[model samples]
Target: MGQSEATVGRWSEATIWLHWLGALLILSALMVGWSAEHLAARDDQPLLFEIHFSIGLLALAVMLARIACRFFQARPDRSQVPPLARFAASTVHLLLYLATFGVLLSGLINFLFLGPVRVFGFVTVPQLFDPEADEWLRALSWYAHVYGWWALTALVLLHAAAAFFHHFVRRDRTLRDFLPGRR
Candidate 1:
């Protein structure tokens, strides 16, 4: 949900903004997807799916930018953090990135296999993969998309819990390091 490191200075404003934007887009897609799940028998479900798909694509773009930023950015010194905690934080950060892309890619591939799904009932999604010929791959992507969502959800919760723990239990500024202008 936030940076894995506790910084001695503030993060770049762009990274901070992207972090919040990515969180909003991801959560919005999750809500829309959940609604579509519950409304499975309804006529408007496809509309929900279309909205979810659109948001997801946006999320993917934001995530890609964030990952690019990561490579060029220097992380805060972890000297103050316990080695185990630092390792765990880094692992969670990596998993969060992987799960995010995994979910998005699998969802996109699954739709391509199931297309031509209409976006907003006007624009038709092209069937890139022949569903009849790639039924097995379609099934695999479907499972990945569904299970990836669950995995991402769990990682988000863990990320948030770590932040809250730093704020409350540890009485540290680690959580504040994630806030904008909190240098």
Candidate 2:
């Protein structure tokens, strides 16, 4: 199927699997981060931070590959949606991608400068930037990461809502567009 028609066609199995896997990983990272923040106040913040940071790195790697695949694949055109709806959908997706990367980068930077980074008990990532580059940057990055989380959460909710609306309300192929071969 061609690009536009592909949207109405059954989604690739690869796409469906990767989409769900990425969703799980991203959600796990968010949950761990939120838990870490709450638990930090009571006990060892270091341990919680380590778990959160590690998960963030994993989520980052997964998202990078996911984004690459998305671009490589022919996505559905938003022109069919209402003008305002299309704009919102595009904006939400853009924000989700940006925030995913931002959170990953910021956390990695923090680990490199302020601490060490251990990824899934596998490899050790070296720090790219010197800690003394700018004190303000670290603070700014931390804030950005925090805000990015909130933004991602909102976008995810909206995305899910829209997909459901198409499935139940519009009675269209919107949900099917992202589902695996004919159910």
Candidate 3:
């Protein structure tokens, strides 16, 4: 039998936690990365870069867990949403995921090209390619990483706006569905 549509629903606790954790990590990483890029070349530049990289890696891990939870858990019922809204939400979500993974992977690739990096001050990640020889690959990844962040930032803003619209304008429980304590 088909499940009944919920007038109000909630995601699993794990999903809620992972969603917020991923958002926090992504925001922190982006800020750190932007700061590291714009600062004057200083002795501490490597440390700042490593911190950004660490945050990006952690965000990637949380995102993976969130994806797994999404697959295994029951999502909040969307029966009340208009078809167009559903389509737009799904499209934005898909693009957000793509941009996030792209940014994280491209950043890793760009970093690897620069040679070994002492991640978090202890672990040494050996360089995967010669920076001088594979400058083109590095450049490509660099561009992708930077542009991916911009795309992600836009998508995130759009996502939040949609949620607020559903909550305040539409006067629905859409926003509460993802809140930590909602049921």
All-Cα superposition RMSD per candidate:
3.7, 3.6, 3.4
lDDT of each: 0.85, 0.72, 0.85
Model 1 segments more than 4 A misplaced: 1-8, 118-123
Task: Provide TM-scores for the models.
Answer: 0.88, 0.78, 0.89
- True-vs-predicted CA distance for residue 164, candidate 3, Å: 1.6
Model 1 agreement with the true structure over 143-172: per-residue lDDT tens digits: 999999999999999999999999999988
Residue 120 lDDT in model 2? 65
Better of 2 and 3 by lDDT: 3
- As a whole number from 0 to 100, the lDDT of residue 32 in candidate 1 is 96
Q: Sort the predicted structures by lDDT, highest score first.
A: 3, 1, 2
lDDT of 3 by residue, 32-110 (tens): 8888889737776788889998898899889989888777667777777789988988899999889988998898888
Looking at model 2, report the run of 10 residues with the lowest lDDT sum. 1-10
Model 3: pairs clashing at backbone N, Cα or C within 3 Å: none
Cα lDDT of candidate 1 equals: 0.85
Model 2 whole-model lDDT (C-alpha atoms):
0.72
Top model number, TM-score: 3
Tell how far residue 61 is off in model 1, in angstroms.
Answer: 0.4
